[model samples]
Target: MASDVHRRIFDVVARIPAGRVATYGQVARLAGLGGQARLVGYALHMADRPLPWHRVINARGEISSRGDSFSETLQYRLLAAEGLVFDEQGRIPLDRFRWDGEEAPAGPAGEGS
Candidate 1:
């Protein structure tokens, strides 16, 4: 029973492609929750589906550390598996990998076809 707000946020997150990423603020704005970036994070934390949560990062082009080293490491590995390379300071170059949110899939993979 995901709330409407969380579902909206998840929809925007699912649109982020495999190799591109979006910031929390960016996803929030796109989900029509502008200026509530933290809401995006909270929704994702409660997400149960296989949304591409790893594709969302902080506005500073780095993963938002949740103080859970395991999840943080898993996020880094997931992004790397999608061919994202981090700089020496462990930040992805947003200019090179940020999604423009123009090419959303019709629905989850294998749906709406």
Candidate 2:
């Protein structure tokens, strides 16, 4: 079975749609993992290479790389290519583009709120 942390992280990451972003803390809360925001970061750090690590960012919408310039640059490039606009400071505008994970309605707008 997948470890609780792994499952939580994966579930959160899966919910994040393309062209949007979610903070690690937001992911932790959505995953029902209490306030273990750092745990989400740790899990992502240990994730497989194929995982979309670049899609997750700090609460301020800044890339989390403290070193490894290549990885950081790659993250920026990938996000930019996905239509995610970044400021001159290299931070994404979270409020304007945050992904709330709400899917489109299956029918007309009158069917649901």
User: Tens digits of per-residue lDDT for model 2 on 1-113?
Assistant: 56877887887787676678888888888888868878888887777635667778999889997589998999889888889999999899999878885752444644411
Clashing pairs in 2: none
Number of residue pairs clashing in candidate 2, backbone atoms closer than 3 angstroms, sequence gap of 3 or more or interchain: 0
After superposition, the stretches of candidate 2 with alpha carbons farther than 4 Å from their true spots are 103-113
lDDT of candidate 1 at residue 52, scale 0 to 100 = 91
lDDT of 1 at 64: 87
lDDT of 1 by residue, 26-93 (tens): 99999999999999999999997889999999988899889999999999999999899999999999
Point out where model 1 deviates above 4 Å: 104-113
Q: Pick the candidate with the highest lDDT.
A: 1
Ten residues in sequence with the least summed lDDT for candidate 2:
104-113
Worst 10 residues of 1 by lDDT: 104-113
Clashes of each: 0, 0
